[model samples]
Each structure stands twice: as structure tokens, then as C-alpha cells.
Target chain A: MLSFSEENYLKAIYHIEQLQTEGASTNTVAKKMQTKASSVTDMLQKLADKRLVVYKKYQGALLSAKGKKIAASVIRKHRLWETFLVNKLNFSWDEVHDIAEQLEHIKSEKLIDSLDAFLEFPRVDPHGDPIPDKDGNMTKQKKVMLSTLKENQQSKLVTIKDSSDNFLRYLDKKQIAIGNTIKVIAIEPFDKSIQVQIEGREFMITEEVAENLLVEIPSLTLPKVKRTN
Target chain B: MLSFSEENYLKAIYHIEQLQTEGASTNTVAKKMQTKASSVTDMLQKLADKRLVVYKKYQGALLSAKGKKIAASVIRKHRLWETFLVNKLNFSWDEVHDIAEQLEHIKSEKLIDSLDAFLEFPRVDPHGDPIPDKDGNMTKQKKVMLSTLKENQQSKLVTIKDSSDNFLRYLDKKQIAIGNTIKVIAIEPFDKSIQVQIEGREFMITEEVAENLLVEIPSLTLPKVKRTN
Candidate 1:
């Protein structure tokens, strides 16, 4: 059985690998975990001994198949719990992440499976991030940053990369949320900030915020026309 | 900020105090926690230092008001989770204790409050154990041991004192459960085993089993009689 600390290390390594593509460096893991590099190195060696990761002295570390599986399972639990908090318990999307973090460590496969079924097998969490299935398989969706949309183009908010409380509060204040139709009104080339309209309200968001917001293009459908005959 | 092990020790001490009625001895706590007496002594001292318990050398330890509050909160979480597992997740009564044990350590006041509302403020868990409220108060109920019921007396099973898996399985095999109305038919003087009728089916249970089962007497209502004209 993995200790909570060990499981957290594995999750950090998995997430760092997603951004870096190459193996995750000890310094990177340390930064993500807010620990010392030496401590991360010690943990990496332990994980390597357990066959959970492949660690090199200086080239960084990569999660083995076993490590990835555990990481994905933990993510699955976290997302499913977030979905339960928001959809069933009436918690807002901004308030569920911290609670779900603590709940993700509960170690019962039957409990998680039952929870997933009880939540009606939600495809994504309240943040619009896909939930990994029981076997650690994720259903991928095509999404682009809100800043990437052209002027006058319309799309629906699909996901938010940074789910920090402050960012979520900002979105809440702007009345922007998942599945809300947004039109890109203009872009400020000076700072790359974008002006968008949602629910007949217009707002300008910072470049960083726009980059963190993912959007999905709406499918095309012909508009109904009045009969002129 | 109590560790899980510390919380478990507090709960054990609280339970032992209930039985002893004075204070919880190191030996008794050790036996209840399945640990060494020396370890229990060390923990008691630490708890005393933290003002969670009052420990006297070679005597027994008693939980401070703060400690009792925390222990009751943990119990509340455990019973509430068990209620959710059995009522919402469709788990059998016998299968929820271990899962709830893990869940009880999750430290989030909002989560528990939301879950309590979601479960509609269940007063008792699947085992018929009263759930502590937010203020750490449990509703007192009048219950008597099954062995205390007289011959031909009918009562409903209200609680099971011993929740061990083996004991629960024994009850399951006998088709006995909480809320089952049982009528005492006879008692064997030799070994003190009692014969009971449930749903018109007769079965004999040993004195030990009878002592562990708690029952409540049903309120009597006058029977209507047809009038002759």
C-alpha cells in the first residue's frame, strides 16, 4: 500500500511530465510539492526501488506504467468527488476542489465505483476536466484557449486550467461558466488581453486569464428564415 | 490538526471511559487499540500535554472537554458516512464499516455538513447506532438487551453492540437485522440459549448473541372489537 505522501509524489511527477514532455526534474517536483530538491531526490530513489518510476541521477525522473496507473486513479477519485460535491451536494464549482483533494485519498475501489455510479457517471468534473475511468482511461476532448478564438467567433467555455479560488471567483464575478456562450469581441494587441461578451454582457480579461480558459467551437447550424412568398 | 492515529486513540479512550465510568486505564486503552500498554501510556502523556486528556501516572486517563468534542465529531463523521454508504450507495449494512472508517478522517466541516443535509439528517446509521449531531450531542434512546425480554414478549431489534464482521455475518445468516420484530418463545436453563420467533420463523440464539442484541418494546394499542346488534 502506498502512503499518502508517496501517492502525492507520484501525482506531482505525473502532472509535471504532462507539461515538460520529457522526464520531470527533481527541482521541478520540489517546486510543485513545495519541498527541498534533496528530499525529492530521496523520494525518487525510493520510488525507483519500488518500480514506480525510472530515476536518473541528473536527467530527471519518469513515471513507470505502475506509477501512471496509480496517479490516474487518484485523479479519477478527485474529479468524481468534485462532481459529487457540486452536482449532488449543491457546492459551487469554486468550493469543491479543496474538499475533493482531501477526499481523493480514501482507499476503497468499491467506494469510488459506487460514487461514480451514484453521480450518474459524470464525463467531466465541475471544472469541465474529464474524469478518468476506473481503469485510468481518460476520454480526451478537443479544446483551445479562449484567446485563440478569432474576432466575432463564438464558442462555449469548456474547461479552466487553473482552478485557483481567486481565478474561479473572478469568473464567477464575470458570470462566466462552463457551457456559457461567449463571443470574442476584440483583442488588444498591446497586452494580448481579450474582450468577450457572455449573456449580453461584455468584459475584458487579462491575457493570462484568457490563456487559462479553454473553449470549444460551436457546431454550425443554419438559421431559420421567414417565408417571403 | 490532529493526526489520524491521535484521533483513533482519543476515540478508544472515549469508548473505554463509557464502559469503565470513571476513567480509561492504560491497560484498557491498550487492549481496545490492540497496542502495547507502554505505547498507550506515552500517548496519554502526549494527550495530556496537549490538554486533550488528563493523565495521572499509574492511574487512568480521562478526556478533557475538548477531546470529547473531537471524538464525538469523529464518531459523527463515521456514522454519517455509514448511513450514506448503505442508504445512497446501496451497500449492505455489513460492508460499510471499513469504508466509513477511512472516510471519517477526512477533515472538512463543509463537506460533512453538506453530506448530512444530503442524507436528510439521518439520526441513526445502518447499524442502528445513533449519529452525533453537529454539536456532538447524541439522542438517547431506551433499549434493553434481547436476553432481558420475557417469554412471549415482542420487541424490535434496535441496535447491535458488537459490530464485528463475523458477528454481523452470523446475524445475516440467521436473517436477523435491525428493525426485525422478534418474540421470545422459550429459554434453555442449561446453557441460557433463547428461542425466538421472527416473522413466524423460530430460531435459537446463544446467550452471548442475545446479550449483544438491543431491542425496543413496541407501544401497545387497544384492539377494536365488533359490537353485536
Candidate 2:
């Protein structure tokens, strides 16, 4: 049986590897886990002993097949639990992540499988992040950062990369949310700040903020000519 | 935040104290926790330090007020998750305990409270065990052991103290289940076995088996003097 700490380490490693597909460095993992590099080194040895990770000192770690299986299973359970919390338990998007984090470590295949059936196998979590399937496959969807949109281009908010309560609150404060239609009206190249319209009201957003917002081009019904709407 | 093992220890101590009331002995806790007496002593000291358990070396351990609150909160989360699994996720009653055990340790009060709301504030879990309220108070209902029923007395199965899959399979083999009306036709004094009729079928059940079953007698209905069919 995996200890709770071990499961947490694996989860952290799996997520860190997402950004750097070559795998995750010990320093990066230590920083992400808020632990000392020595502590991460000790855990990496243990995980390597357990055949859950491929470790090379000062290089990085990659999940082995067994490790990936566990990671995917954890992801599946986490997203399903989040859906249950939000859709049935009446939890807001902000309230589900922590609870789901704890729940994802439960070692019951039957329970998670049953939950998958219960939620009708939701393809995404409450935060619009794609949920991995039972086989650990996440649906590949096309998305671009809102900052990349040209002036006067129309887009729809498609998803969020983070689901923390603070992140969700920030989105809420900006009146931006999943399914919200947005039109990029102007971009200031000096600071890379963007001005976007929501419900006919214009709002100024920072470059960093725009990069975090994921959007998809709205399908056009007529020939497009760039015009200020 | 309590580790899962710490939460389990607290819950075990709480239950052991419940049976004894005065306190719980190391041996008793060991038996309940399936650990050695030394391990229980070590855990007891840790719990005492945390102000969650009141402990005396040889005498035993009792839940402090703080510990009681924690235990009740864990119970509430457990039952609520069980209800969610069965009602929303379509899990079998026999498959929810181990999953709920892990879910009970989740450290989000809002998540649990929201789940309680989502489950419509269920009064009991799938096993008919009373779910503690948000305040950690359980509704104490009067129940009688099936073994104590008099001859020709009729009652309905309300709950069971044991939730093992083995026990459930055994009950299924005997055609006994929650909500099934039963009539005790005879009590064999020689071995104190119960002969009961379930859904018009008669079977003899041992005293030990009957003792584990919880039954309720409705005041509005008179006891059937004899088996109807």
C-alpha cells in the first residue's frame, strides 16, 4: 500500500512533468512540493525502488508505466470527485479542488469506477479541465491563450488551467467564466495589455492575466471583415 | 491537519471509548486498530500531545472534546460520502466503506457541508447507520437485536452492525436484507436459534447471526400472531 506522502509525491511529480515533458527536475519538484531537495532525493530513491519512477540524479524523473497508471488513476478519481462535489454536492468550483485532492488518493477501483458511472463519465471537471478517461486518455482540445487573439477578434472562454479558489475568484471578479463570449477590441504593444469587451463593456487586462485565460475562436457564420464591434 | 492514519487512530479511540464509556484500554484499542499494544501507546501519547485524546498509561485513552468533534466530523463526512456514492454514483452498498474511510479524512468543512446539502441532508447512510448532523450530533434511534424477538413477533430489518462483504453475502444467501419484513415464528430454546419467515419463506437462524442484525418494530402495526402465508 502506498503511504499518503508517497501518493502526494507521485502526484506532484506527474503534474510537474506536464509542463516539462522531458520529465521533472529534482529542484523543480522540490520547489513545487515546498520541500527540501534532499527530501525529494530521498523520496525519489524510494519511488525508484518501488518501480514508480525513473530517476537520474541532477537530471530529472519520468514516471514509469506503473507510475503513469497510478497517476492517471489518481487524476481520474480527482476529476470525478470534483464533478460529484460540484454537480451533486452543490459545491462551487472554488470549493471542490481540496476535497477532491484528498479523495483522489483513496485506493478503491470499484468506488471510482462507480463514481464514473454516476457522473455519466463527465469529460471535464467543474473548472473546465479535461478529465482523463478510465484508460488515462485526456481529450485533446484546441485552445489558445486569450493574449494571442488579434484586436476585434471574437472568442469564447473555453477552459481554465488552474482551479484553485483564488484563481476562480479572480476570474469571478473579472466577470470572466466558462462559456462567456469575449471580443478582443485592442492590444497595447508597450505593455502587452489587452482590452476586451464583455456584454458591451470594455475591461483592461494585463498580459499575464490574458495568458492565463484560455479561449477558442468563435465559429463565424458570415465572411469576416475586421471591424470594431 | 491530521494524517489519514492519525484520523483513523482518533476514530478508533473514539469508538472504543464509546463501548466502554469510562475510557479505552490499550489492548482494546490494539484489538480495534489491529496494532500492537506498544503502537497504541505511542499513538496515544501523540494524540494526547495534540490534545485530541486524554490518556493514562495503563488505564487507557478517551476522546477529548476536540477529539470528539474531529471524530464526529469524520463520521459525518463518511456517511455523506457513502450516501453520495450509492445515490449518485450507483455504487453497491457493499462497496462504499473503504472508500468512505479515505474520504472521511478530507479537511474541508465547506466541502462536507456542501455534500450534505447535495445529498439532501440524508439522515442515514446506505447501511441505515445514522449520519451525524453538521454539529456532530447523531440521532439516537432505539433498536433491538433480532435475537431478542419473541415467538410470533414480526418486525422489519432496519440496519446491521457489521458491513463486511462477507456478512452481506451471507445475509443475501439467507434472503435477509434491509427493509424486509420478518416474522419470528419460533425460538428454539435448546440452542437459542431463531426461526423466522422472510417474504413468506421460513429459515432457522442462529442466535449469533440474529444478534448482529438490527430491527425496528413499528408501533402503528400490531405483531402478526402467525405467519400470513
The per-candidate TM-score of the B chain, in the order shown, comes to 0.91, 0.89
Question: What do the candidate models score in CA lDDT, each in turn?
Answer: 0.89, 0.83
Error of 2 at B94 (Å): 1.9
Candidate 2 global CA lDDT score: 0.83
Error of 2 at B201 (Å): 3.0
Where does candidate 1 chain B have its weakest 10-residue lDDT segment?
A: B217-226
Each candidate: RMSD to true structure?
5.0, 3.7
| TM-score per candidate | 0.93, 0.89
lDDT of 1 by residue, B1-229 (tens): 9999899999998888866689999899999999999999889999999999999999989999999999999999999999999999999888999988889999999999999999999999999989999988998677888998776678889999899999999999999989899888888989989999987899899999999999985455423446697
User: What is candidate 2's CAPRI-style docking category based on DockQ?
Assistant: medium
lDDT of candidate 2 at residue B195, scale 0 to 100: 90
Give a tens-digit lDDT track for model 2, residues B1-229. 8877788888887777666577889988889889899998999999999999888878888899999988888888888988988888787777788888877887887887777887788898888888999778998767788887887778888889777899877987887878889888899989999899998999898898899888895454555455688
Q: Alpha-carbon error at A195 in model 2, in Å?
A: 1.3
Pick the TM-score winner.
1
